[model samples]
Target chain A: MPYEKTLEELAARRAAALAMGSPKRLAERREAGILNARERLALLFDPGSFEEAGLLAQSVRPEMAGRTPADGVVSGFGRIDGRLAGANAADFTTYGSSSAETHGKKQGFVRAACEKNGLPLVYLNECAGGRIPDIMGAAGIGRAGEGGRYTRRRSSPVLAAVLGLTYGGGAFACINADLVVMRKGSVLAVSSQMTTSVAIGEEADPQDLGGWRLHSETTGFVDAVVDTDAEAIAWIKRALSYLPDHANAATPVQADHADGDAAALLDLVPETRAKTYDIRKAIAAIADAGSVLAIKDRFAKAAVTAFARIKGRAVGIVATNPMFKGGALDPDACDKIASFIVLCDSFNLPLVFLADTPGFLVGLESERRRLPGKIMNFMAALELASVPKIALVLRKSFGQAYLNMGAGRSDTTAAWAGAEISFMDPAVAVNIVYAVKREDDPARFEDLAKEVAKGTSAYDLAAPFMAHAVIDPRETRDYLARHLDIFSRRLTGAIGDHRLADWPPAF
Target chain B: MKRTTIASEITGKVWKIEAAAGSKLAEDDPIVILESMKMEIPVSAPIDCTVVEILVAEGDTVAEGQAVAVIEG
Candidate 1:
């Protein structure tokens, strides 16, 4: 009879804790079109798959007894698209999802569980920073679980979604995550605008403070922005589908591609070297249809970096957009490529460089941006990458940019018949060498330009074994598909070291 | 009716001015093109509006997030 009574008490306590927050508060959240913590979990995971772990953990602070349910954080293991994942959704209705001592400990446990079980960690953050009194003293200051510092273990992927106001611990987790997605109207920042305004002595509007526009275009903190929580969840599922469950596992592959005719590749790039076209068209032509997921697209216009598939196998793609600064490598573009290469190398994704760049941007503005340091950083990352590297010269590959874009010693090097590999543009070379203007000595200038361009032709370079093949522009998709398949099956002398697995996503 | 300012997303030279002041434009109509990173990014009207002012010339250098043109709906 005592055992039955104890079991009944346990069930009652669990039910009370799981109720989350006051009914009025829950109604307010719903009125604001925000999903409750439990509802977020339901949308994030497969039906009937969530097994919560901390329903009985009430806040240890005596005054807050029965006030904070699940310590304001509902954490557990669940099936995300049928694969196991560790997840936590901050219960904003409970004390504004403030960080209490028990909540921090639970989060640390959740992150560790994901690492130990070889599952991804997913965080749905809507926290309002730390609970003031709970974290005010020396004991509170020393607490380790308040932020995402426990996520240092890189054995599993950490993904975060900011659904509403996210400050302090919640902001730290999102910013530290490998990939972060945010809802349209959500705010993500180090501290709330109220606190920030008080500290900085300036009025701050929530709309302009760490908003979607700032993160997406200016800061690049968010990877994707969605209109609703459901779309954010869908994006998470899609991103997970491209990657393995853990860093140690193999990447997933899709077997079919139904993109339009591959022959359309010939029309994507212009015949005139000076004319600019969108390289995304060429990317679509070569990769499996609908498989190109671009990274940092809004940040660096000159470089097109994306994760794509060729014949179902995953690959990292880097291409120069000749339309932008003549496809030159600027400071921002250099950093973009370097970081992307590191990401692919960490995950064992083979790299494909579509070379159409003229060279590095040269000017006072470039110097001000510390182009030399950025160029060196990019070169180091490219040289250190251990994955199979392929370079395809579609039009122009000039000066040091040629080597940086995977020309020399890349596993496979190919060029279109019309491509040119040159030390610099012949026009620029002519201007530097000749004292007379083109109008004064038109014939001599034209002759000198032709002479400078002689050995730069793709056919000429291929004859000397500089390039492996000079292919027709239309055959690009077929050629890349064949080579990627060959490279994927190559014999490895040792397992991949995955050195960049711990690289900070934002830095 | 409300006024909207079209801003540049990057630091670049003004390559071309596509719309003149007082011209009526549909949503997404180009006002001016900024050349940066060797690419042309056309600053477009957010909604149906009339070009109220053109601030920068073709050769002018503009900083990121700078408003280069004004439009009134």
Candidate 2:
């Protein structure tokens, strides 16, 4: 039949591509429990959505003739989920997937496809680094940097995944991605552990060179991280799900859910103040169930950030946990919060702030982390976020943090509430006010502390209208829902152009 | 008097403007927030000044070099 010939021809071409880049060595990729180029493409793209290009591309060199799988790069057009997505799969099996003149051609190939087609672009990077022998000459490097290929190709969004050791070119591309998700235990850096160690005269672990810890926690590099191959795929899928197929269109499809009664939140907060509970519990009960996917769980344990749905609408949740270090905004916590704010604003996710900060961290350690700059940056992120924000002061908000958390200013507000906002902690205030008396008149200090604390309580701030409204802790669920409704439908708000994705993974 | 233009570093449309034309602003006054790379990068005034012009609309794809607003000091 005519169909049989077409199928047979397709198989021959695919087999040829795999073989070009030293098919035998592809086993190293398989050994790591990851899929090969074709398999990965198949898994990533929606069923029957891929239409590949340059299948039989090969090496130009005579000695390397008939070799180079898809010219060591899998460039193609595919639909990730019925929406167009263009991509490049660098073949690590050929010359370590190093960046070479020939390899650079394929890079341009995929980037051009995405730019021209108006589809989101991705790079499945698994490389050893820059091509060694070919990159030795100045002309080779010059040709490689021709025409500002990466910099000029900024019209479309680019995402990357690091599934194996990514150094040299691989690392650059991976880090430059708008959104990067890397497999746990994999390394990504400017140089490999051995190479950097040899150069620096130190014993280096690749994990130290670029581990999940280095990028995610210390430097705020990679955006989202996953533990398994499946999670990596799902993370990519989920990220793309929220974004439009291209920059020109609307956000992708998301299902709607009915708004629930505020009564369920009557028992959301614990009756006792001292007892601690998971903040995620309150978040899930209020937002669309099963849609609260929290990002950056390991870093900044004090504040929590996640993508969720409030009545099936995409929302960004930023909350504090008094259970952690009294919910003080430390440097780590500030960096974590500031980055999340940037991400949500970029993605058009409206914000829900659950404020419970006693104040920003004080003392020497907090200062060492450059807490002032971090706090200012956090405020800058908040000020820059033109998206709708509904701030609820859950328990305690004191000092300058009260204003920074949106208690003052009509900047971008939908609603505000539920807090005990004051100048300082009454206990600390009382000690300073009566420091000379505690030893001479111990009972007097106790009475004064209690009286001052009551005046600065949640009710006092509520009566004065410093906060929008002070409600029962139980009302936080419905209160947020009402404001979130008002924020997301705003057609008039300031939004900047796309730039953050290529910021290079932090570490 | 010196004037400066601050731009966003994200891939999002300009969503909101905190400063208005003719409004006096202090150093680091937030001018605009760009929604890009899944984050909001705010462009602010570098010094105390009065707003001269806002270059971006509510929803504009401003590149790194693209000015969101201009402030005259």
Candidate 3:
């Protein structure tokens, strides 16, 4: 596209494109190598197909009257890849994107646009929390909804960027989102680290306060962390690639498995006891390549809570790796699993559990962390999960861990087994009940312990109807394909309620 | 220029070192492995720096938040 127009024509076109207070800010953003709000909208939406709403709305306060800044937030409807999407921007530089009826109109408009049009909402938030003195006191408190969250029913995925200090209402937008990306050195916190540190009487490092480490590694809060705003935009594309414009749309892609026999999936797990292998390897081998996005990798080393593609179809993979501290659920691990299950269920993704846990981790730390509470929540999540779920005990399905993995009755359970389902490891069971001897009387104790541990093996549990079937380990992939095929999604999508969207980001 | 050292986040014995002394390293290269609660926790590099020295070896118990080695940040 060559520009040969006259200077006056070019200026006219530029003036029209700049909207209200966008030109000066756009120039500043261009100098900083940052995309302006309108530029971001161009990057997100389909070219030549953006129709904005309230492009000229502004503040209504007497002190700030005549400010046609669109209340510092822009709301519009556009088609992205032929799918309708709503876009909104909070003008960080303008009145702190404050809630004084200026941005309120656009914020509510964005929420309404998403709900009414069945489109994902995209928010580019870089605000100084909510407005201070203005949004305070009785008069300020009166316009409170503008200061907080007004969710759009989770009808469509909401993606947000915390390019700067994502605090107060800005941070809430990211937290409440289905996917959030934080730029390096930027933060996503309830309040700035200074506020947190001052309250706690400790020095604050952004990375230590609302830092990337706190969310990504410690709390498992943000979905992704990138070094730049550009990468954040790219991640938004990737996240949207998995989801539809709305729940009403059938999955865009079908399973890659085609007509079955995606090779015997059972051989993925090794038969050896001591040799530890990565459970992710099995997931990748069985599922489509590059489709698995693991969540909370560092928090729960035992359980692998990941979103993967089985046959190109989206599914949540919850598998326990015995290699990681013998794949025993700890309090942290339980919280991770429960939250993931609820999330996947809400998103209408099928759940695939690769069980190989010896049960919840025991000892002082587990007890102190309130392991029982974590386990109860996990049970509740599983009970409430309405998505298609299939659990496979790859090995070591000892004790309560098996039940937590969704075995036992079929009220909402689809417990199938690989060759290695057990009540408990013979050594542990003996130590607990009969007790393993440490030399001298070791032979007697080991024999006694072995008898008790025999209950840990798969057959013992199977006879009691704990595990529905004990299929060979190598037959796992095939069995999973068959089970996921039969599971239904009729009920989950009909209601379209993801209550956990507003739930706390972490345990 | 000053050097900073990243340490094992938890109390444990050093299990292994994934980086060699004097080797050029990235920001998060693991210097040693700490064994705590029967689990292996990785002690990562503080910043982009050369591994100037190896202060602790495998099998050495280290406390939580304890610096295991120094690196030019």
Candidate 4:
């Protein structure tokens, strides 16, 4: 009892820090079905596993002393599903969780801890940007970027959840993360509507500016959108289940689950060549039961990129979706696939490309979106990935999309018995080559088209060894499982060089 | 009741008309099938509704984002 007075003061200060903002604001959040910063962290980590850091910290400003609890953020390290991880959640009740000198330091502490410990990092973002008056001067602005907030090296898996109105710093964190999930009504924008209206001289709705629909469908920044905060948290946990703890660690594996009937692929995919079906069904049939987690599922309907397990091991699947744009590779699809490739390669997950594309889309709109540059970026990421890659030509793999979808770029290239590999459709080729349209000269056009299509079959590609094997549609599941086991990194210990680890997460 | 205008998501020639103007359709029911890039793409119903109008006939070419049908739910 020698330090009785000191201990009493400590208790009082801790009590004040624990009481975030006020009772009124906390009750309002609860009524609105939103989770507080501490609640979010509690839900993310296992029970009784979180260890708090900077709990007694407050604002350095004399005028704001004792007003900002934990410097407007809650940060620390904990175990997520029994695996060590680090996190920081913005305390919106405290000064709107605005960025300040002390707030930035708290986030920096968690980031540094994750990097040092080689653990995954989760960011529960709900902020209102930089604090006014405090961060107005040049000196204050200089301290804002002190912690490398914009830098992402993929040293560890980074996931973000936008559970409320997130702006400026919070929005940047969401975009820079390897995977982002957002609540349906939340907004993630560079600036709030007030500032945007002042700068642009036009009022913009928050939903229109950076709502979940915009990010999910247009910007392609968010990987998934859920109806509630708990749902968003669940998505983050599910995504982490398929990734390694860090860049240098081996991917975790679980007991193998039974796969869906492989014969279903024969019916899921039409052999008639011109018929379209949902590629998701085929993906589900090939992967272990209930292991497919589609990424950016709403953004690029023309292509599908997902994380799945085969024989209990993690893998990345990039397949063409024939239901949209005739399964062509458009600008958005290219960006989505390239970003996903970078994530999987960083985590040492082997890749599988189920190619059934007509080719890259060509048009005035595609050109305006810089399709050429996007295609090159996709190819670069594909080439830079050091993990094992297998490209299975399921139907049509034409033009540059053939190479882009693995072909010579992958470690193993195979095709179904009815797959086609051609520069263009034979009917279109005949019209261009011989100047004979089907309507103009039906018999001549038919003969020329047949002749042109002679060397484009799956057998033709396998005969010259362009395709390593020609398989049956029913054998797809078994073929991928066995080949993945064979090409798995027995010598390298299943860790990749991570050449695309530093690639930008957003296009 | 809400009135909705369904649009074609891609540029293609209409290959088949699967629903009539007075038909009641469920969500995701194929209203029209289009041929583009040598593949059949369906323009499905966005919601459960009664088709009010079919804007184009089979064999007519439609641009992407063009309104193809009207429905009342």
Candidate 1 stretches greater than 4 Å from native: A145-153, A323-326, A433-447, A492-495, B1-18, B22-50, B53-73
Compared with the true structure, what per-residue lDDT tens digits does model 1 show for residues B1-73?
A: 8887888755778989999999999987778887654345677788999999999999899976689999999
Instruction: Compute the lDDT of residue A476 as modeled in candidate 3.
Output: 60
Each candidate's chain B TM-score?
A: 0.95, 0.84, 0.82, 0.96
- In terms of TM-score, which candidate is stronger, 2 or 4? 4
DockQ for every model comes to 0.27, 0.01, 0.16, 0.74
Q: Compared with the true structure, what per-residue lDDT tens digits does model 2 show for residues A1-507?
A: 869999998798778775645546667657767767777777778988888777776666656646566666777888887778888876777777777776777677777777787778877777887676667688867876764355633345577777777887778777566567888887888888778768988788888888888877656566677786667767877776655545444333256675544455546655433334456667777776677777776666667887777766667788776544445667888877877776666555667787666677675667777989989888877776666777766656678777667665423332223345578766567767767345567788789977777766666665666556666655655666676665555554323343332322332
> Which digits, one per residue and each the tens of the lDDT, describe model 3 over residues A1-507?
356467667576445434545457657767877665666778778898888776556656566644445666667878777777887766655665655555666677777768667788888777667666667788776776643355535567788877766678777777777667776777777777667777988787776778787887677676678887678777777777667676555445553543323344455555654334567777776676677777667666778888766666777789887556556788878888898876675566777887766677776668878989889889888877766677666655667788888776222333334244555655555566654443447878767865665545556666776665676555565667666666644554333345544455546
lDDT to native, each model: 0.81, 0.67, 0.67, 0.90
What TM value does chain A in model 3 reach?
A: 0.84
Stretches of candidate 4 off by over 4 Å are none
Backbone clash tally for model 1?
Answer: 6
- The candidate scoring highest on lDDT is 4
Q: How high is the DockQ of candidate 1?
A: 0.27
- Pairs that clash in candidate 4: none
Model 4 agreement with the true structure over B1-73: per-residue lDDT tens digits: 8889999877788999999988999998999999877778899998999999999999999987899899999
Q: How do the residues B14-50 of candidate 3 rate in per-residue lDDT, one tens digit apiece?
A: 7788777677888766688665433444566767888
What residue pairs clash in candidate 1, if any at all? A324-B37, A324-B38, A324-B39, A325-B37, A325-B38, A325-B39
Interface RMSD per candidate (angstroms) = 4.6, 14.8, 5.2, 1.2
Candidates in order, TM-scores: namely: 0.89, 0.76, 0.80, 0.97
